[model samples]
Target chain A: DVKVTQSSRYLVKRTGEKVFLECVQDMDHENMFWYRQDPGLGLRLIYFSYDVKMKEKGDIPEGYSVSREKKERFSLILESASTNQTSMYLCASWTSIRDEQFFGPGTRLTVL
Target chain B: SQQGEEDPQALSIQEGENATMNCSYKTSINNLQWYRQNSGRGLVHLILIRSNEREKHSGRLRVTLDTSKKSSSLLITASRAADTASYFCATEIGSARQLTFGSGTQLTVLP
Candidate 1:
């Protein structure tokens, strides 16, 4: 079974504070993704990495960044957390771009 | 990821009945995929259908794609209470690596 683990299930952060959400996948997948799920916005891609040190901006890359120093772990970083950025953050991994993505449980972040 | 739209934002049905949801995209896609997410949880991939293919099935789930119309539908037959979840349709365009997802259809299968 493919297992994806997130650093936190729920987190609270103050405005202007930096936040780091970590994801680790047991499967050696080549592609890792970060998405934020909102009520009506669906799952908007924040960033994705296809290989180590390789990253691409997705539809909503603003106010956030990502790092993938290794194949199994990916991280989403908020430079300065804001209230508007509060949402459910998810991390996923896939062996290939065309393959199914396995996701972590998700981290619900609240920015005050 | 090509931004796709799913209709009937919410659906309610009894167990043993079928639940159908539709999706439409604006751009050419290499494939269309469906995923299910339980409340407050991450998504699980349900199925995928290539643009060239018209239909596919897996277990109790059936998927149909119409490339000409840039649309797709997912039908969950004989659904059980455990099948209650939100269903999302996502489209992946050729040469693109990310998936653009629809808001999703909230499915509630009652006992």
Candidate 2:
């Protein structure tokens, strides 16, 4: 069984504050992704990393950044948090040969 | 920016009834996948159907992919109250390994 764990389950931050969301996967998957889910928008990709220190911008990557310091860890960073940045963030990892993805329990961030 | 579109944005069915959901994509895909998410939780993998395959089943969930039509369908038989969740269909383009997801269908299985 694959396990993806997020650093925080729920977080609240004031406007203009810096925030970081961490994710780690037990499985040695080669691909990792970050997404923000909204009510009507479904899941919008924020960023993704296929290898260490490598990253690509997804559909909605303007207000966020990501870091892949290690194969098992991926971190999402908000340069300066705003109220509109509040969302449920999810991290997922998948192997090169497999089509299935393992997702971590999401982090619900509330930017006040 | 959405690649896949799911029909019937919402569905309501009684327990033990079968529920079917449809998804259509714009571009050619290597594979199609179905995922389920309970309220306020992370998405879980359900099934995956490759381009060459038409239909596949896992437990009570049946998935069919029609490459010619660029569409797919998922059927859940004998749904239970625990089946009340949002179902989404995703498409993986040639070698990207990234999935483009559609707006999910909200399913409510009344018990």
Candidate 3:
């Protein structure tokens, strides 16, 4: 089974603070994605990486960025956290061979 | 923009009963997939039905797809309390690697 792990399951930060969320996958999937899920809004893509050092913005990438320094690791960074940034963040890894995506437990961020 | 929309945003049923949820998408898709998410957790893949296929089943879950109508339905039979969760339908459109997800249906299986 593919296992995706997120650095933190819960986090709290003050406004204007920078935050980092890390995700690691045991399987060497070529694609990784970051999404923020909000009530009524569902899951909106934030950023995705197809390979190391390559990243693309998704639907809602403002105030957020991503890094893929290694094949197994992907990171999401918030340049300046705001209260509106509070959301449940999910990380997923997928490979071409499988149609399904393996997801991490998710990180619930609270920007006060 | 949201590509898929699920009908009956919320559903409640008693255990041993069957629950059905429907999903409708806007564009052509290579495949449609269903996922289950427990409260405050990430989603788990449930089933994937390609555009070429009509129906598929896993365990007690049955999924049916109709390309002409651009809609799909998921039926969970003999539901248990453990089946309580948020169910989402996602679409893989064209050659896009990412999936567009619907808002999801909250299913509560009462014991």
Candidate 4:
């Protein structure tokens, strides 16, 4: 079984604080994705990396940035946390051969 | 932009009854996939249906796709309490490696 793990399951931060969310996948998948899920909005892609040091913006990448320094690790950075950024963040890793993504448990972020 | 939109934002069904959810999309797609998310958890991939395939089945879940209509349906036979979760429809467009997801349908299975 492919296991994807996030650095934190729950995180709380104040407005203007910098936040970092990390994800690691054991399968060494080539593709990793970051998404923020909100009520009524579902999951909106923030950023995705197909390989280390390569990133592409998704539909909603305004308040977020991503880093894939290593193949097994992907990180999401919030330049400055805001109340509006409070939502569930999910990380997923995928390989073309499987045609499916394996997701981490998710990080529920709360910005005060 | 969201590629898929699921109908019936919420559904409540009793165990042993069938629960059906529908998804509609705009534009052309290479494939459509379904996912299930438990409360406060990451989503789990349920099934995937390609543009060339109309129907596919896995265990108790049956998925059907109609490219002409750009719509799909997921039917879960004999619902169980454990099956209660939010279901989402995702579309893979063109050669994009990422998928666009729908808002999702919240299904509650009552015992």
The regions of model 1 sitting more than 4 angstroms off are: none
Look at candidate 4 and give me any clashing residue pairs: none
* Residue pairs whose backbone atoms clash in candidate 3: none
- lDDT (tens digit, per residue) of candidate 3 on A29-81: 99999999998878899999999999999999999999999999999999999
Better of 1 and 2 by DockQ: 2
Consecutive 10-residue window with the lowest summed lDDT within model 3 chain B: B92-101
Question: Taking the tens digit of each residue's C-alpha lDDT, what string does model 1 give over B1-111?
Answer: 437989889999999999999999998898899999999999999999988899999999999999999999999999999999999998888777668899999999999
DockQ of each: 0.73, 0.83, 0.87, 0.87
CAPRI-style quality class for the chain A–B interface of candidate 4: high
TM-score of model 4 (CA atoms): 0.99
Q: Per-residue lDDT for B25-64 in model 4, tens only?
A: 9989989999999999999999999999999999999999
Model 2, residue A64: what's the lDDT? Answer: 94
**Total clashes, candidate 4?**
0
- List the pairs of residues colliding in candidate 2: none
Q: What does candidate 2's lDDT look like per residue over A1-112, in tens digits? A: 9999999999999999999999999989989999999887788899999999999999999989999989999999999999999999999999987779899999999999
Worst 10 residues of 2 chain B by lDDT: B1-10
Locate the minimum summed-lDDT window of 10 residues in model 3 chain A. Answer: A35-44
TM-score, candidate 3, chain B alone:
0.99
lDDT of 4 by residue, A1-112 (tens): 9999999999999999999999999997999999999999999999999999999999989989899999999999999999999999999999988888889999999999
